[model samples]
Target: MFIKIPLHISGLWYPIITNNPLTTGSIGAGINIALYLTAKLRNTEKCGILLNNEEVLKDHSRAICGKLGVNLSVDEKSPISLGYGFGLSAACLLGLSLSSLLVKNITIEKATWPAHVAEVIYNTGYGDVIAEFYGGLEIRVKPGPPGIGVVEHIYPGRKVDLIVSVLPGREDTPSMLKRIGKETYDLARKLIDELLEKPSVEEFFVKAHVFTSKIFSYDNIDKLLSPYRSKIIGYFRKKQALVLWVENEWLDEIYSYLNKYFLSFKTWIDMYGVRFENTS
Candidate 1:
């Protein structure tokens, strides 16, 4: 049986790795609790996840079963879990990796893991959900979780253009996190604090972009994920990659090429310009 799991936006990357936990602002990273209904499974009754993908599911499931000394098989009737993490590849990488570690403690693993698993969802909790709802670019505060603290939501209606470089090989999020250390996070916090002093949304965009670029340009990063570098860079030269136009005019053209080039590993999921009618 097919099941649709609903998620509630709870925490975000920025807050989760902040120097001062008190500062709940905008979340540049996205995080959520995936509440799963496991009635389909004959053995396990229910399970929920705070993960971005199923890569660590098998290991996690194994840990849980081992600890409890009960063998739970992944039969055809097993419960299905699905999650989607879009935007900020780095944050997604971190969150997903951390969750995997948490699952490993339980001696349980994912019955099945997806091809690509994000480590974390990096977004300011403020606009992650709103952006997901509207399916557009958003400019909001850091540490942006809903109803957590004094963190407020402000939609500037400004277009934040992105240039993403999708490389072939996967970067190790755990290793990268270790290398970044507290100093890196502190620098980001300081920059964010400065931005908060006056609070200019436009200025914030420029600063945020700079911060993002710095993270992306880390020496280890460029070298680790070089396979898709050329392709991601190539997109920048294309008018569509740089500009913000939400029209399906170029949908077929783009996918046709993607299906041909990244046939082995990559495929387009949801094109920004496409419109879906509500039939339900």
Candidate 2:
């Protein structure tokens, strides 16, 4: 069986000033989870997947790998390699495909598959999706699937303004998570706890844009932005929103920056409550 799946982009987990410690959560775009699952079901060592989103492929691989006791190697040889997305693993995807083949009793040479049936590309975000729906700054509660969870902000008075800058590079979330480890998450949790203890008497809406950059390591980012590093920082400093460079393009001129720098930059579309500007 030939499995061709359409990857869905889920919303993101943006931080909001809330009393709840779980200042992270995601909202679903309600489009293509089912399709991803179906395509994943038909897997074999020879019959793998052709997907756009790396995260989706990773998820599919993990699920299938756990089902069958097998380990597969990833094919790093690509005719032309392109950045997958935020926190995606190509090796994991290859592992899943190989395992799927073993379990399905099929080979890659004999698989006959047509055009993907549910070829629907739904736009989604993790941080932006959470903020747009829940409002305020929020952390991504869950990483795997796009699902919303309950979060309560105990503190109501303290307000923060984020001056986000779009750096011309990509930052890998998975690598960051590994590097930051529990320290970053622990700090985030502590901050959330601090907010909860001190409730604000009034509600305030902070104008902020959390910029994502595909630049993973600081050294790599420095190399990419060696030309206009100051200019990019100046742009965000002027905007005055907290800058969070992520490894993917989620929005507009922000995305252009990614292409310009030959890197991925994260921006907000409808996901983070940013209105889509009509360019046509």
Candidate 3:
């Protein structure tokens, strides 16, 4: 069995804050880029994981070794750096849950619940699991487990290219939420409402820029993108990274610039969410 799950790029999300600590997911409104977690089952003398990160073994992936001789290994790319839009934590858990279908048949909703709960418990992420579960640019209207939480997707009808670059930094999502003043949250919600009115890839980023401005300072961003700011569809700093949604014409120039200064790559947004296949 082989499964591929898309990573969530929530560099832009309006957290749905609540008093209850257990219900602490966000109202995420952003699309997913093509970075992935790939897993496959193979026959081997002993069940083992061929991985570079020890945390994967110490935590989520170890519990599901299944029966002996069932060799399942998951490989992730780009090794989502610290404060780098989740470091693909949700993607790793989702892949593990999806692979369980090969051992025991279960509904998709059932598969995703554990992954979402684990994410919340560990404080690694919030609405990202649900966001990746649905794919596309989603507004998580209800924040909780997958079976109960509801998401409204904004379909761009075409895959959009998003340029990403990680910087050495840190962002505590829960702390960031607490830091946001009520005025900012309310205004961001109003922006979301406006997005639903005319939801397009272009418009989503246009609004994202406004949302980002209220939360953080992007002074360095202006100087870096001065020459090509006009072509930018959306620009924001998230997870200690810089993500830009831009017009295609200037993609190469901007990409080159990003590569020169930061660890950058270009990936496309997908609406299909997570996909898996039996490769044994």
Give the candidate number with the greatest TM-score.
Answer: 3
Compose the digit string of candidate 2's lDDT tens values, residues 67-90: 344433233222112223321132
Write down the TM-score for model 3: 0.81
Tell me how many residue pairs clash in candidate 1.
57
lDDT of 3 by residue, 155-216 (tens): 77764667887755666665766677878777777877787787777777777777877777
Those runs of model 2 whose alpha carbons end farther than 4 Å from true positions after fitting are 1-48, 52-59, 62-177, 192-258, 264-267, 272-280
Rank candidates, lDDT, best first. Answer: 3, 1, 2
- Weakest lDDT window of 10 consecutive positions for candidate 3: 62-71
Candidate number with the higher lDDT (2 or 3): 3
Please tell me which predicted candidate would have the highest lDDT against the true structure: 3
Using all chains and alpha carbons, the TM-scores for the candidates as numbered come to 0.38, 0.32, 0.81
lDDT of 1 by residue, 45-86 (tens): 322222333333444344434433444332221122222222
What C-alpha lDDT, on a 0 to 100 scale, does residue 71 get in candidate 3?
40
Q: Work out how many backbone clashes candidate 2 has.
A: 50
For model 3, which pairs clash?
none
